[model samples]
Target: MDLHYVVQGNGEPIVFLDSGGADLRDWEFIAPSLAKSYRCIAYDGRGAGQSPSPIEFGDYVEDLKNLLDFLDIDNTVLVGHSIGGRIATDFALTYPQRVSKLVLIGPGLTGYQFSPELVQRFEEIQSVAPNVEKMAQLSLELPSYQVVMTSPQRDRMVEMTKHNTLRGLEWQHLWKNLQVWGELPAIPPLNELRVKTLFIIGTQDSEDCFRIADLFKQVPDIRFAHIEGADHMPTLTHSLEVSSIIREFLGESKL
Candidate 1:
């Protein structure tokens, strides 16, 4: 695949998509554990980590399709976090047959309207411009990161944020706005999400996250989960819990 990716284990496949500015580092704790029971695929999206920068608006969903085609994975589990969740959501909506199951963690929707406060906070972070350090610091100033900021994973999160921030800036406008990928104008209602799904969010995350959770209720076959004491990056702060939740949802499928 053109995107930098790692595959592990050998059971049912599970493709992982990280947050907007994060890389495979977000799943460092959880993916390895799950790798014991499920084949895991984690990739660094364009302009993040080792992945090459996108020269234009990125078709992340299409990129995912290419990756699956490259790996010869016909149908598998889809696990996405943040913007990655948005990618998975769109991909599932566009190609439902390819996803046997779907899991979202603090995901952004394709056409969902974000709160003004959230928009402003992000804008403030961008106002700092090319000074990626300031941009990275402000990006994590949201209420959602409060817990992780105080946890042991704070340094790792910070490190990844800073590094990715630099990479994003280096991509120059090719990265586009972090909000929207190359999404179709129309996003099918949650009621149309036919694949079995699991929606997870941190108890301390943004209001928009909770709002998204409420929307997921329209899905006929979906489970909702919460991570207490976690904000945005629960995969880093509560890896074991998240892993266990996923394991339970996915059941005992093995090699």
Candidate 2:
């Protein structure tokens, strides 16, 4: 698909994938910091930014595979947020040999089924919103969505979020995939995973996030960090600490 990206530094490749509704700019705040120590590569997922929109989620995975192949990146620590996390897990499961490690930040896994109320609310906000101004206002004002934005990040987030095509996301398909794949539980499945993993979740995120993160308590060779006072999008809310945590984790757990 010839996706575009911003590559910085030169060392171990750490691919940072943003959550759905966000673009590569989502990583702009932290990529430079991470680049100081590792090769930081951040790109807009297919259908998000400069990348071409795909027919399906599997197409997104194929896009990632092709990007890596094109770059000759044989070993990488796939860092993903939300849906990006789901993709990373799926990639690791399907091609274990290529992944060096995994880091999920508020990863949207298929663990807990989305409540009907939550799904309806999300659909209303994403699809049925009467206008962009209303959607932007609602997103910034709502507690569930506010955690990811500060005064600075809020402007950029609004810009990127508005780029999302409400119809293309197919909320039903996303919900169905969450139910199916999350049910498999990536945390437990990691026992079969030969690589190391690190999961970061904000304390203020959804209960479902907390519940799924809890499932990883027993998995060996995995480290979990809770960023206090942060929400689903800590990369913007707590960039300094988030970047520090990731760098330290990578340094300590280098393979």
lDDT of 1 by residue, 23-102 (tens): 99988998999999889999999889999888887789999999999999999999999999999998998899999999
> lDDT per model, in order?
0.88, 0.74
- Native-referenced Cα lDDT, model 1: 0.88
Judge candidate 1 at residue 142 and give its lDDT. 82
Candidate 2 — number of clashing residue pairs?
Answer: 3
**Model 2: colliding residue pairs:** 82-108, 110-182, 111-182
Report the lDDT tens digits of candidate 2 across residue range 1-255. Answer: 467788999999999888877778778878898887789989887667777655545556677788888889987989898888877876776777889988888877544566666656665665545476666565555454666666456777777777664423433364434543234442436456556888998888877778767765545678899998888888887888888888777774321
Model 1 TM = 0.94
Off by over 4 Å in 2: 55-57, 126-130, 135-142, 165-190, 252-255
Give the best candidate by TM-score.
1
